[model samples]
Target: MLLNLLLLQCRAGFESECAAEFMQHCVDVGQSGFPRFDAQSGFVLFELYGDALAVIQAVSFRSLIFTRQWCACLPPFEQLPADDRLSVLLPAMTELPVCAELLAEVPDTTAGRELLPFAGKLASAMAQRLRQQGVMLPRKARADWRMHLFVLSGRHLLLGVSPRRNGSTLEMGIRRLKFPGAAPSRSTLKLEEAWHWFVPRAEWDARLGGGKTAVDLGAAPGGWTWQLVRQGMFVSAVDNGPMAESLMETGQVTHHREDAFGFAPGKPVDWMVCDVADKPARVAELMLQWALQGWCQEMIFNLKLPMKKRYQAVQQCLEEIAEGLEAAGIRFQLSARHLYHDREEITCHLDLRVS
Candidate 1:
């Protein structure tokens, strides 16, 4: 049976691109889904072919917004009441199963040009209508999550709600408003940005649940190590240097006071995480060796970039790493991005498996 599937893509510079890439990746994993076009919203729509909840969970966790683009699929459309259009589509849009009806539909209006009461009514009615259909997510049951709504041009209203940190309204406003004089802010930690960029917490937990272990190279201050330890996993933090007092206190982290290259785990670890201040090629080599030797099941590492040929460097590094891993007959999942947290660098995550 054809089913409606909505994909939530992230916005660039706001770490939304990562979400977008994941959505595209999901498209490639086509057994469970397929893509359709929603020219009305100016975003690609998807036709789900598997579990309704899986589609919702995947897109909800990926996109920063609670965006549900329109798509055409399945039967029983004629049976659905006109008011139930949005509700019928909600369950297929995310991992949640919600049945809602459109309370009202309002025409498009430009921002800063004075929105009519009907516009506000349209949004409010949509919310209330969903509540009536038991579509409202239980707030008391899930206190940690926050939701944001973005009304894009062309009457495209997308939602980006999550149960994570509530982004600052200033930051959100800056991104959405795009004020002319806004300078690119750099106060945000790059590694934190990379965490969200490379791996969402859900996927990270899934990897761990799948029995993934990890090695954190150059884990001095222990920022990255801290994250790993919190995940209830063992970490081999390699560095001749001392770890932060706080990380060492955790006891879950093992400090290998030696060159990361010279050291090897007694057995294969599930992951090898590197945040070293080394040349990109060298970092790539270390990652390749681990994959080629079957040292780890997956890897998330960083490559410090030079001033020149930034894109060229990334391409070259990817090629060399791919060739090396392929020569060793290792099949893997690999991704790289100019993470919001990275400066003059790009981070790579590789999931290596024997399949």
Candidate 2:
């Protein structure tokens, strides 16, 4: 596609935050664009007044926190006849640069879920049509671009393009997981998703395994701790509350009856993970303190977002952390995301070792 606009997917009810962030980023990159989005549309479109190819090249998709998925797009096609929709969809699909992959996606809303059956059928029909048109490569055939068909309803859809390595490979930018029956609480899934998102699989054994040591602050009932233990890492589970007995019997966890905010590891450990429910500023500061003291080489924590000015809160916390690290001459890699398993807060991963 000779794309001129950007379609950004985000969590429903967060369209404003996504729009605000996207606008600021585009401004930073010197790209001018005006945004359009409904209150709960689960998407924001920045119709570019400047060149879109220039804009996407300047603004890395990973730099966006609020946005789940991004694609440079042609304007949406609407009101296709219920029958023979492929005839209408194929023309736009064929005009695109041949993409290595195709994703038929829907908004993460109740209405979108109802169209899942239709989405599947649409994907199959479009793939066959595009194949005949010589516009799409077979799946995983090695190409830089990805094609996305985002469906609003049976009769409406948008065609977009994204760099394969720059954004999520998953459809709809969602990482769905089955909750473990043995896990103590549903909160475990957040940390599990964190590892899945932040860590590349090839480095998992080297960075995440080998009987490494970890500390889980606010680890009562053992949600985050279970993931560490599952990876063969022994954990010092720190919380004032009682832990799940099933985890205790594994002989892998040492439960400490102490306040997480007040506790420190005896020595620097391989990892420190916290899921304490507290103010975002306090949480960011607490994580930084561990970094300054070299208490842990890596840390993952959640910042509970305030109800208002949520985007401002996120930027301030991240900026403070970045400035503190720079002033201390500490080299680090820091990133935050609003993950699928999270609500009202975002997860952060901070590594003291940049490489």
Candidate 3:
């Protein structure tokens, strides 16, 4: 069969949560599986007792919070002779569905980082072989499945398949970004990445235009505020601490020395961004209040998770926000992610679809 197992990738040390999510997905799809994973391994293998096409078709990648990337896989090709790795891998892929692209991926771990160079070489060689063998087709339409090779070592690897649009676009489900020197803090990257994931790139110019207004709660030394300034939007930076003078000098920011929970924008703003270090529920509640009261059109914020039941925490917070918004007759779009830049917290983006 083409697929009997699944390979899932996530941040290192988040394997248990990822596994729990995958297990629940299988149940949701009416399939059964026993998850195999080691905590902090950065990957999981859900060994389905039968085929996996049902779960693959039923679950959407964006709906999963902990899993970064996933593929329906056949059993691995282990213990291949070191010298001729491609010889074994090529024949295995021959019987699978049509594939136009091959992604060479590794776990997000110390050892996996070291194998990157080797994975690249193997992918290059395999791509040529696949083309020559007529297994790889020209992707005229964007509908083809992308083959994934989860390389654990030069000799041991698991092969899998994922639909192009249904899975993450980045290789191994990780986005690598260089921090800007002028940004006030590394936290700036969190909001920036959330923008890329939530706001479509083409719509950025329209939605994030200059002259638009924004509010940054808990803004201090202004990390999130810096991004708004760069967008050419005026910012009401709410916090008691001092802000970066360089940002203040730009005339784009008005620093408000006050508590975020107690602070209210004098008028509705274009965007609301928060990174307050509080309970996940509280942060989520603050966002709900802003949306319900018609204070901001869009928002991006973080939820600091607890030591245990992290998945449950994220779900409860998001659900509460959705319930509050819907009950109050507000229509909106909401999404969250355990972004590449986030640590012990998940980032969320909410847009009140008010004209």
TM-score for each model: 0.50, 0.97, 0.96
lDDT for each candidate structure:
0.53, 0.87, 0.87
Candidate 2, superposed: residue stretches over 4 Å from native: none
| Model 3 C-alpha lDDT per residue in residues 102-201, reported as the tens digit of each score | 8889988999989988887898788888888778775453545788888899778888888777888788888788898998899988888888888999
Better of 1 and 3 by TM-score: 3
**Could you report the Cα RMSD, in angstroms, for every candidate shown?**
11.0, 1.4, 1.6
Candidate that beats the other on lDDT, 1 or 2, i.e. the better one? 2
Order by lDDT, highest first = 2, 3, 1
What's the distance in Å from true for residue 21, model 1?
A: 14
- After the best TM-score superposition of candidate 3, give how far the Cα of residue 8 lies from its true spot, in angstroms: 1.1
Q: What TM-score does prediction 3 earn? A: 0.96
Locate the minimum summed-lDDT window of 10 residues in model 3. Answer: 136-145
Give per-residue CA lDDT, model 2, range 46-67, as digits (tens): 8998766567667878778888
Give one digit per residue, the lDDT tens place, for model 1 in 1-355. 2234443322222222233443554565553454543323323334456643344444433322212122122232234334444565445334322322221211122331243353355456556655655666543444332333333322444333332332221212112222222111231244445555556667766765443467888877676776666666788889887777766776777788989877789898877788888889988888888788888877778888776665557667888898887776778777675543455577787777643
Winner on TM-score between 2 and 3 is 2
lDDT at position 354, candidate 2: 72
